[model samples]
Target chain A: MIRMRDLRKDFSVRVPAGRLRREKRLVSAVDGVSLTIEPGEMVGYIGPNGAGKSTTLKMLTGVLSPTSGEVSVFGLTPVPQRTRLALRIGVVFGQRSQLWWDLPLRESFRLLRHVYQVPPAEHEQRLRRCREMLDLDAFLDTPVRQLSLGQRMRGEITAALLHGPKVLFLDEPTIGLDVVSKQAVRSFLAELGATGAVTVVLTTHDLADIERLCDRLVVIDHGRVVHDGTIEALHARYGSRRSLVVDLDSPLPAGFVLPGTSVAGVEADGHRVTFALDETSAAAAVAGLVAVASVRDLSVVEPDIEDVVARLYRAG
Target chain B: MAETGETWAGETWAGGTRAGAIRAYAALVGGKWRSMLSYRASFAAELLSNVGATVLDVTTVFVLFRATATVGGFTLAEAILMTGLTAFGFVLADLTVGNIDDLKRYVRTGQLDTMLTRPLPVLPQLVFTDLPLRKLLRLVFGAAVYGVALAVNDVPWTAGRVLLAAVAPLGAGLFFGAIFVLTASFAFWWVESGEIGNGFTYGGRDFTSYPITVYAHWFRDLFAYALGFGFVSYQPALALLGRADPLGLPAWAGFVAPLVALPAVAVATLAWRTGIRHYRSTGS
Candidate 1:
């Protein structure tokens, strides 16, 4: 359904220097990356910030013309064939609202009907199906801004798919959502992928999003694809442990052992501690921390693929 | 064709019909109008400001005519007609590029990517989506003033003369719209387009408001042959009043509306397409 050969996108950025001088620099956002996505496959494109994940998606959707590359969506060059390719694909940008901000959700759907030229009957059917699947009818009349983030995201997803696109490209579909909203989006995507109707390409920084929704994982960094495999393979090779940073009110004893985790690191003052825990042990570790007398600040940091890539670079 | 309600099985056009495209544009406009409607106070304020600006422009011309028998050989009534025509020219230009102020925002905030992903062509969606619908009032107001000006001036009524007066500015407005398109296209390359575009869209409108004879010969030629603002009001008014062209243009130059404006629009369209072809969207 999609193919990219040696895709490269270079951006010129200006940097201010000294009092009154600026430097022009060309930064390669996507460099010599190649990819092929088949129909009915859900692939998660993961990378650290500025790691070319969004750039690749933009090229696939024909939003950006690559500096030096060959890109074909449904066998047509994406840049020249962007408009035609657009008909076959739908994209959801997580950070931005694609629906009209002030209009009701149903109004946006109606606009999409004209935009994609869906027959009215087909549009109604699609809307009914989407509303049922996403539980959208509850707030159908609400303006997009009035809805919660999760509702708005669901609205965007429905709008993107109303045209029945062959491929769905999502950039961060679950950012800034409450736990329940995140779970809803994850389940929705999983169900959508299970139906085997449309191929899905998702780019997100969140690891749990990848773990739940993706059948295949493609990791990119510094403008190149670093890993292309299954989640198990990523876990096996760079199987990461989660870190829980806890600041104690006072120094810890020399031989203290955390209940469910092993000590990962400690700051100069023994009050700062990092505990490494597996996914299942997270709740127990937090419970262990609750038992401790005094804690200043506590945060659970997810597994970061950038660090995994960096560790590999250092070892190589 | 593929079965309905199924994901496209293969490559095919998505709603490529002109009717569908027009429907999409109307929806886009309707969406923008509703968005503006949400801010009713802002819309009302903007409408009042535009009407105030028009009134002030009329007062400037009226005060000048009051002080002298004729400024640049234009009678009081002729000057008022020029005011009406110039204002209409602006209204026409704004129809296409009224919301161009949003173009810069779209670029900076990456909304352009959202637009490009749609099945519809990007240019029409961008051009028509956020048009300032409130500005249409200025045109109606201008037309009313034009009728009063023609009546007060007591110019002999002829079909050719009245037709020229109406059609000429429409063409000129298209020409100004062409400039708006050009400036938006330039934004794709330069990334800062508002100031530069204003020089043409706003500056050109201001320059053409008065009689071309009010300016020195060099300035008049620059704005006429060089920038194409002359066709907006000066040439058409001259032809309507049956006065000779003082700038050495052909006596039939007032009818050259299509000759000048159409090509300008064509060039602007070409520039816009090129800009899109090489478009490097802001940060990834």
Candidate 2:
């Protein structure tokens, strides 16, 4: 449904090249990226900050025109036929909202009903479904600024879907949400995936979001796509070992071992420890850590896509 | 419904193409209407400020005409008419596009980001999103002041004169609106240029509030030809008052006020498109 050919986006920025003088410099935001997304495919376009993920999304949305290369979505050039393409695509920028901050959430939805030109009956049906699916009824009359981030994001998702867009582009949709809110978003997306009509392109820092929502993963760094395949393929290429970080109350003796887990690294001070464990044994490693030392605090660091991608970059 | 997620990519709207866009514009306008309702205090304050500015403009004219019976061939009555017309232009421009200063805010706050993603054209959407209904109050008050000035002037009101006077304000408004749009479009390339609109938009409008011939020859030439402010408000008023324009412009130039305004609208639109093509999301 979406296709790109040598997609390159360059931004010309002015920098002081000499004293009392500045020169325009062209910086490549997305360089030589060739990608194709099929209909109903949930793809995670993941990257670190300034990794050109947002740039790629902007180009796809036709918000930013590429300096060189071609990009077409649903057989339409996004920049040339942007308005038409917009009717078929919905976008949610998680850090920002498209909802009217002052208006009630329902009013915002009604406004979108016009913006997207959904029929009244269909709009009401979508609103009812959105309210129920996203649990938005409690705050439908509340002003958007008053709604919690979780509720607002759910509202945003509802707003995006009201027109029944064929392609949904989500940028960091799960950022800054509580556990339950994250679960709500993940499950909503999971259900959407089950619907099989919406193709989602999600760009996020949260690998768990990628894991839960996306079947295919595309990783970009420094304006280039480093990996494009299944998450397992990325893992196979760059070792998807989950890590457990624990603050020990005391130093561990040398050669301390936990069965089925390897101490990935131990701080010189011996208070902080990291363990690499299999997906299943990650829970067991934590349980075994209680025996090894008094745990101060611990967290299951998500699949280290960044570290893996960093390694892949170095190796390349 | 029939398995929600697996729809085809090539889906078209069931309704007519323009139906959605037209409805969307209405919704946007209605939403803004309600939002503005919540700012009654600010709205009132803005109305007072408009009235205050008009009072000050009239005071300045009275003070100038006090020193001399006539300033640059404009008697007190004609000068008042000029001030009234310019006030109308100011109200018109501000009502339509005063939020040009807010263009950078839209870009910085990422408002424009989401706006571009919509299926609507960005410029029209921005206009709808930032419609200055508050300024309409200023327009109403300005119209009242304009009506009073027309009455006080006791100017001969032929059908052609009244018709020309009535449409002349719209011409100035269109031209000034184009100025506002053009200045705001500069923010896409140079964000700092956002406030630079004050020069042409305010300065030009203020200059038109009195006789153009009062200014020195160089200044008049600069504003009249270089900036086209003469054709905007002054020329129409000149034609109405039966006075030849400064700088040898024919009196009939006033009838073609849209000629001045249309080219400006065209330029503003072109600048806006160029700006859109160059728009880089804030902070890269």
Candidate 3:
């Protein structure tokens, strides 16, 4: 539902040397990156601090015009018809809220209804659905500023989706939420994607959010998309090394050597041994360790999404 | 989610256009009024403080006028009229355009991103977001003080003059609002120095309160021709008081207050569009 082509956003920043002596330096926030988001696909855009993920999302949502490229949302250029594009897209900034602060949640929703020109019946239906899904009935009458962060985030998400946007751009939507709240938000997004009505692009540092909600991943670093594929594909590509931790009842054998297995480290008392295996079967590695020592307890440590993305960055 | 709950019942709601703009304005004013009502004690104290400060300011002007008796061929009474008229215009500007000063803060902190994504124009939305009801009290206080001063001076008040005097404040408000827009538009390029542009906006009002004749010829020309601030207070009050035009403006120019506001607003709007473009290019 969204397409970006050779997008490049360059900023001319003044290099301040003194009051009278300064020069302009061009910095590219997003450099020659392009991607397409299909309908009902929840894609996670991951990157380090200044990797231009937020810039890319802003261009797609009509909030920022790309400097030297084109962004089309559902076949319309976002820059040329921003107001009309606003109707079809919804955005939520995790750090900021669009709701009126002093007003009650219901009042904010009503104001949004008027602003979006939502029909009365559809507005009512949407409110009902949103309240049920976001669990907003508990504090619907409370002022938004008085709400807890989790509750306020729920309100923000509800407000963004109230217009039934064809696409939703969530910038760090689950940041700073508690564990339960994060899971709730992630599950809600998963259910929304399951409905197949809207495309979702989530930019967040939280790896669990990606693992829980997004099936496809786009890893960007230094203003470029370094990797783009399914979660399993990313894991398979950069997540081959596995760590094996074995707790032995007795000390390891002297000069023990297992084929394709190297000792990573030895913990206290030399009873716990850690091994790094390269493209080796987990069962075979366990058997090799068991054969060399009396195993008490053992576990395989598979790399999570965080380690995989971190590895990609480190490799780059 | 209650079906029977209804807020903003009688307020007219619109997102754009002149009529719709008026409706949105009223809604904003109503919202501010309700907020002020919620803190009655604080509101009363704020009103009293405003009155005290205004009285002190007027007393200073009165003392100066008693000493000089006339300035630039304007008698003490004419000077009072000019002062009162300018004060009224200044307060009206504050009431209407005060939010524009806050616009830079919003933009710098990424609050403007929320505003831009909304369905309404960013300008009108920011205006409606905060109405500044305290300044509205100042507006009433200014008009009342001006009315009393005009009565005490025994200036002949015709219906046309009264209408022009009334409309002058609104025109001045729009003029100041346009300046604020122009100032806030600088945030796109000079993000950290948004407040530097405020020197022109608030400083222009300070220069308008006194007769423009007192300043040097270059400064007077700057305010009149370059800034067009003289049309905001000086010319309108001159026409209302049956005085000769200052700055050699045409005698009938006061009737074109709305037209004068049109170009300032148009230019400010263009500047704002350009600023948004720059912001998009810069991406922060």
TM-score of each: 0.85, 0.87, 0.87
Docking class of 3: acceptable
Give candidate 3 regions above 4 Å deviation: A16-22, A239-243, A249-280, A284-293, B1-40, B51-59, B145-166, B245-250, B253-258, B280-284
Candidate 2 chain A: 10-residue stretch with minimal lDDT: A307-316
Give model 1's TM-score versus the native structure: 0.85
Error of 3 at A292 (Å): 5.9
Using lDDT, give the best candidate's number: 2
Q: Which stretches of candidate 1 lie over 4 Å from their true place?
A: A236-316, B1-14, B154-162
- What is the TM-score of each candidate's chain B when compared with the real chain B? 0.89, 0.88, 0.79
**Against the correct fold, how does model 3 do in TM-score?**
0.87
State the lDDT of candidate 3 residue by residue for B62-121, as single tens digits.
Answer: 787777877776776666666676677667766666667776677677787887776567
Sorted by DockQ (best first), the order is 2, 1, 3
Global lDDT of each candidate: 0.80, 0.81, 0.76
Of the two candidates 1 and 2, the one with more favorable DockQ, higher being better, is 2
Q: How much is B44 displaced in model 3, in angstroms?
A: 3.8
Q: Write the per-residue lDDT of candidate 2 for residues A1-316, one digit (tens) a residue.
A: 8999999988888999889899999998888999999988999988778889888898898788888899999888888888888888989988778999888899998888788777777777667766777899899999998999999999999998888888899988888999999999999888887678788999988888988889999988888988899888887777678788899889877888887777788885999988887544777888887976898989888776667766875764
Model 1: per-residue Cα lDDT over B196-275, one tens digit each? 87887777877777887888888878887687778778877777777777667776887664457888889998988897
lDDT of candidate 2 over B85-172, digit per residue (tens): 8788778877767777688888766568888888888877888887877666677777876787778775666787888878888878
Question: Which residue pairs in model 3 clash with each other?
Answer: none
